[model samples]
Target: MADIGGVNSFRSFARSWRRAASFAEVIPRRPSFVLAPEGEAVDDSSDWDMDDGRSHIDGSSEHSTAHSRQHLLRGPSLQSQGSEAIAAEFSDGASDALLGGSPSTRSSIFDVPPHLAAADVIGSHSIRYGTINSVRYRSRPSVNHDSPWGVHDEQIDPEAAAMTFGEDNPILVKEVKQGDKVVLTVEGQSTLPQSVFNSINAIIGVGLLSLPLAFKMSGWIIGLFILTLTAAVTAHTGKLLGKCMDYDPSIVTYSDLAYVAFGTRARIIVSALFTLELIAACVALVILFSDSLSSLLAGFATATSWKCICAALVLVLNMIPLRWLSYTSILGIFSTFCIVCIVIIDGLVKKDAPGSLWEPARTHLFPSNWMSVPLAYGLMASPWGAHSIFPSIYRDMRHPHKWERAVNTTFSFSYALDTCLAVVGVLMFGDGIKDAITSNILRMSDYPESLTVVMCIFITIIPLTKIPLNARPLITTADVVCGVHREHAHGADAAAQPSALVHGVRALIRVVVVLVLLGISILFPAFDSVCAFLGAALITLISIILPISFYLKLYHKEITTRERVLSWFLLVIFSILGLVGTIWTFLPKQLVAA
Candidate 1:
């Protein structure tokens, strides 16, 4: 009876120990070990959980039990099979903690191994053990083992750990890096806007306005040319718009569009043509101002001195910031006001000058009427020179569908303005409107000098405002050409910088081109002849030929039915009208004088 009781007691203790160790292994607090009593050698039996209902020993013999009891008197060593099992349990607990599980409950009975728990395991000494309880006991290192007592190692809470390691690891970092690179590239570059393109178009418009005035052609013939010019320009612009849309729309600029259409050689040709046109226009403006001043101040000042002063004044005005205003604004405010004044003066004059308003009608059958044809032709051609504006306007429009509306509005408004001016000028000047009506408006005896002065000022402002617009295409062409060289010699970043070097080079090119143009103007001061030649050559080339050529080049194979019909019409009309105008303008006086 005594022996059986002792066995049952030992079995109960072992069962309790196994249960505690198993729980500790899973929960994972710290490293654990088993110890024997004071002086006995270590037993060889492996420590394990058993499933028997009764806690009494079943596998071991009586001799083995005695040996295990005797071994309990000595301190534990890991060499024993039972000690290995205990070490494994503790190791399991430590691994669980590292993998983010809670500390094991069994760790409360035997503290974790010091070596395993130390923060700097790579450099720290291994843990040692000392017994306390009669059963065997070990002290646990405090949870704050890495720091001083009462000083906690800041635990990474579940929420923060999950956010940092789980959520934002690779995905967020990649996204942030990409965003940063894009912003840096965009910030480093400068882009030109649609407004700049619109100004270029307005400059072209000024040049075209003089076309009809210079080509002694019929209104119907001029109208045909205008229609052909419009169709060609529209087709060309549509093709460019298509190209721009093909790439990323953001990458397309006016300069890029021009380069895409005409290539590098075309840029040079266009630049030269633009320079010549501007200089001729400027000279015409200067002469018109000089002549007006000579006539207005004839009694008070010498014609030569007045002309010099007026020329100097115009030069000074051209140099000022007023040159930067939009062409539409300048014309709308000054030119429109002048036209209104001319109409008012003409209306008032008709009351007293009785038959003068009909004078133009009488001369309609005369040879002088042929002069009006050229003048009207030049005037009509002016509005058609608005090709460069297409890119600007196209970009501004919200959608391609809006293009027709915007273009039609602009053209219709321009045509109305031109037609009204022509009719009013012919009626007001009668036989005397030989020169530009604005110029001869002051000479009309029935009109007040104040009105004429206003008219002169208004007309003067139109040409003055156009200087910057005229200079832009040349500047842009030079910029693109030089920019290419700079990009190759330096890097893209260096070339992109709008520094003193870029501005200086651009300015130098402008000065050189303008000087060459000024030389041409001096050699050919006849406004009528310059306007005629320019109208016949550049206006036809830009408005008629270039558009057709570009459209065919860009979309010949893909043209729709409407586009095909329009293209054919443009080709035929432009060829016929351009050829006739060229031939007529070049004919000798003896051939047509009869």
Candidate 2:
């Protein structure tokens, strides 16, 4: 036999074993190279076929020199050294070919950096880090640039290429943008019915009180046309505003929509408008409160004292947490019902009572001239000033996609009732109607003082209730712009509770906001003056321009030519209305009267 136990035979076996071990390849624990699964074999067929498809390769490698032939044959055995002594099986001539890389990769093996070469080991079962042909890998044939035709080649992110998606997964993919996948979770989202009613209440606010005056300023023929037209147009605007939110689900306020449509300048302009509107609204509220309570008390309290009392009441009322406001909105429904009853009843009473308390009935079919058209046009736009909060209502619905239904329902009810009130009040009282239909009732009434006080209280409460609803959006938009809102948003990963300091700071901000508004109310107590300023500027922007611009920018291609023409027409018309109203705002009270 072959010298079974002799020292010389033993020494020869040892030499051959050491030679195999010297070139044995294995996976090494390195940071850059991902590890293959334990005990999994390297895929030999999928990787470098001595034909890794990069650079020049002629199929005539079959007729290549002995050196190339040796390389092609030895590459597999050298690469297949997963857990076995594979390199040993490769011949010494083949070993030289294998170590020298491929005809396509390079002729030299020393191309591996000195630092990398120093770290390289074989037979340790450590993963090899090198390129063969065009393929590069860590542990196994995780990447395969090799092609059956020896044609195309591409590199993958190594971490990506290393993923073995497993037998269950046929491919791998990743997101292009991460935040696009994040979902929004608005707290206190209303059920469909509640949301609809909340929208109704929001849409049918103090603006309805002015429509009869609009009917007087514009002719009844023009007034009715403009009134219905404004409703239809603004409702469409509300729809456009809602659709813009689809561009980004993260939008939570009206100003945010502005931010997305334009940029920082637009955002700041919108924020400034909202802030301005809120301050004006609070001023209106103070004026309303003082007027209502003074009307209630008659000789008992001064207007200034009534304003102070109303301010105190407002401060207390606003302190009620937002969570409770949803329930308070039901109170708004009652307020609407009572005000409607009061209007109808007071009209009946005025018709029956002595005409001495009312104005001499001289109703104008058209304006004495055209200066009044600005106020009339502005009045039509003003009723739908609820556009700012429309998105908030839509967002807080359970099925937000059906928001248009809620909007339509709101406008339908508000319009029907407002039209009734405007036509009836103007016709019954004639030119006797005050800017507020209720003012007619207050003036013409020979009613019980108890009824007058009750009417005053209801009038006061209606405007008072509106302040917080308006202020919330302003506060929310401020938070968003200032970067406090994102932190405040209660994400799934958010902290369980805010720190006490955070709560205190938030409370302080709310106080500061309310105090600033209170100061504005005190300084500019002329409610009509404030209304004219905002009606000209802020209301026109929210009700007309912003919505028109958003729809045109986002979906101009989708809109029909006719629709686009009509939209542009309205945009131009409203732009002019906004300008005229702005000029009208600066006119003397005498000029407005003219």
Candidate 3:
């Protein structure tokens, strides 16, 4: 009987595997544009690498060409040759590509016919069409000073370079035709190590500070389970995003991916969500900066006063361009590491049992109140909520195939760091843990004063630096909306600098934005609450639901039953969790008592 059961189980597994294999075999890569005859002009920039961000077009095709080469798209191009076959690749047959295999196998870049270069391209701001064998490409610009986005285009063997010209690959942003000779820009890519470093940087942030409290709110055991579960699920969704990008290497940003999945409506919704998230994040930073500083200087001033002062300081500093502070951005990761070390060291040195630092407390395996578990869900989700930019990191990678490994490494490191903090906090404070573990550490009866000062400095200064980083994109978006910035144009003035009026308006807008952030922070001063709400709402949708939905939507027919089932299950679970947590956050305490 045992042998028969074993055989039956094996058969079931084999059948399921076959079903998956069949589905994989049936999916088709998104259709690419058919190659037009040489000299036949086509306007297809809208079909590829389209972004909402204003294109920075310099009249010099050389600069644009250099930029395009740094961002080479790796995927199979459309091999069909005909004028009638060109259509938007957004259709079902064109978008349903199965994902697997290395970059070399999963993609084959066919040479684009020489004449296709006459049309406007989509890969970079400006692309000069170059013929394969006779192509004259330039080396990438200086890495240290020119490429702020960290682009590097190294020279490859000419024979190997010829394979990157399929119609579906290497988009030309602005076609600069100079005497028939195609000027192809072959760009270099970010290596596996660089990609891993970037992914780690994105994943680790202020959110880790809240994990200790998350464990306190949910049962420590439940929190541990939830942390592990959230990491795995979020990483899976990140991979889904990578798969979506795989279908069309042109998908550069989260909003771009949305546009691919459900058209204009999806793009608008995702873009709006991203904008709101940025504003909310700035508000949170304001509160965090003020909160940390006020804790240290309790008798100095009112909380509202502290917030305004900080906002003013940050606004003044942010008026300087992002490039000025680009180097300081890396300090964010170091600050987080330092905070974690302080928490661990303090947790070890302090011999106090649960509740000694505050009110009576006790360590528990389960939460006393299950109602708070959803909030914990949001809190735990925060640390793994960097999915908004995962697509960007994936696109920048030299070996796009190693994206899964990068995601795994990032999550593993984050999980280990979060777990260490949560365990120490739980063992020491239990339910009494503050929203920020650092806050709880500061209250310890015998805590080191020097360490408390250092923790406070990290909390305050780091947010100050981040506020501008978060606000810069929003400011640029505002500039476009207000016409302070212009679209792509021709002539010597195409790359002309913004006028004085434009500069004045930009500075005014930045001030208004900072003031608005200050107002919101003053109104909602709870750091944990802000973090939880953002995590529950925006982060949940961005990091969890949307990626899965987009992937399933794009590859609906091609995906296996198991894949579909698992995806839907995760979708339902997280949707409910986010919704419940968001609603609970605003519910009246009186209603809860009833």
Candidate 4:
């Protein structure tokens, strides 16, 4: 009886052991490689295959395998140790073939995530996760050979590339380098509607006020044709500029386009031209301010005194951060739109007033003075020179793909406003129209007092607001030239308080710039001449010539024959207009009148 009881106990014990073993096999365990302590024996016959899920034939003797395992365990550093361990596990008879590198070289496998570590690890038993062949580990820097900016095989800048591809949503990426480190920054994007508003605001400025005089000089027939042609060509070039950016993500400014198409010399030349254009615009603003206020404050002060007042105000107001200025910039658009409405309403209501269409007028179907036609063309072209800012607007957009739509909408709205003002001014004032349409309205009697007050307020406010805005680029360029900008540009130093000396220097430079602009305004207060010259010379190059030239140079191979023809034709026409206008600028008004 005792022997039988002992046998039953042994049987029960055996059954319990079997059940425990089965349960242990069923339980899921985190997958990991088992490593032996230093100098321990490693199994040469693979217990579990690390590759091919089959028994690994250790064609390398057991001694060699053990020696390699020991070497991997004693790797120089933690990162390197991890690399060697991976290479050892993946190694076959030809270790280099399996490791994807030489035995002495470290593997990039350590740089990959665990899941991605399964890539090319076919049927491996050590790692049971499903394998993916799609995303392979990249051991080399990515080179973009197809950049439209003519930068070929250029290794993408890591900081800039991170900004470009690291995010899910599109962003305006910038990189600031300090010492040896790089800092990346991203700015929030503007929506389509916001972009459209900004684009329109850029287009509609003091230029709109001069269009009436522009029409008077060009005549109704020639004026309308030139206006239409200029708008269409400039808008098209703006679109081309956006596409150029699309082809090369690195380009962030108009000058960058020039650099890619040509070289550093081109970049410097383009930047200098753009700088001159901005300075000219600042001069125009001063003239516009003085003219508007001088007309309003008629016997109280001369235009020179008003110009001095404007300079003082600009120097003070520019001290306000550009961010705050941008917020108030929307008022400029509203002011301009209001001025247009007042002009249309006043012109229609006072139809029988002096110089109205009902009166005998010197309205010309063609330019009475053929020499003035170039001047007229320049005036008409002035308002369309918003191309410099298009790249900035494009960069700020949330949906950059919708850029063409925004361009079309902005140009269409601007054109309509321009056309409305031009037609009404010609009909109401005929040859009596002053350079500023508002000046014409202000001089006439029976004009609604409320409308005149509104027009005066709007026109005067515009130049005051625009002066600092237009001068912003020059101020920044000054900062760079003075060497103060670099001290602040360092990313690590961004939060550090700027020195008072730097502040004082910047203030002094700004004062000098504003004072110089004041002198120019006082020296050459011919508002129409300045506007016409800018339209004829700078605007033609920036808006018409540069964009088309850059586009042709960048996309010479890809662009169709039709596009090529149209681009060259525009180049020819605008080149003539620019040259003629330049000649008109230098010619004496007395001589031209004769």
Q: Which candidate is the best by TM-score?
A: 3
- Winner on lDDT between 1 and 4 is 4
Q: Could you give candidate 1's per-residue lDDT for residues 205-282 as a string of tens digits?
A: 333333223322334345445535543464455444534432222212232333334443454455455555555555
Question: What's model 2's lDDT at 7?
Answer: 31
lDDT of 2 by residue, 1-594 (tens): 445655335433332222111111111111111122222222333332322211122343222222322333233334445534433332332343311334332221111111122212312223222222333333333322332223222223433332321101111111111121111122223555656655665566666666777787787778888888778988888888777655443344564455445533564566566667666666766676676566556798987787777656666766665434434544555775677777666556553533222432556767665677677666666667777666655654545667788778888988998898777667666665565666666654475566666777677766567666556655544443333432211123233565677566666666666677767767766545455556667787877788888777655556799989988998898788788877876677578872
Top lDDT prediction, candidate number: 4
Quantify all predictions' global Cα lDDT against the true fold.
0.39, 0.53, 0.60, 0.61
Q: Name the runs in model 4 displaced over 4 angstroms.
A: 1-171, 174-188, 355-360, 486-500
Q: Model 3 off-target regions past 4 Å?
A: 1-188, 354-361, 486-491, 494-497, 589-594
Worst 10 residues of 3 by lDDT: 20-29
Worst 10 residues of 2 by lDDT: 166-175
Give the TM-scores of the predictions, in the order they appear. 0.53, 0.61, 0.70, 0.68
**Regarding TM-score, does 2 or 3 come out ahead?**
3
How good is model 1 by TM-score?
0.53
For model 3, residues 568-588, the per-residue Cα lDDT tens digits are 999999999999988866665
Model 2 segments more than 4 A misplaced = 1-192, 247-253, 353-360, 398-401, 448-450, 472-515
lDDT measured at residue 60 in model 4 versus the true structure, 0 to 100: 35
User: After aligning candidate 3 to the native by TM-score, how far in Å is the CA of 75 from where it should be?
Assistant: 24
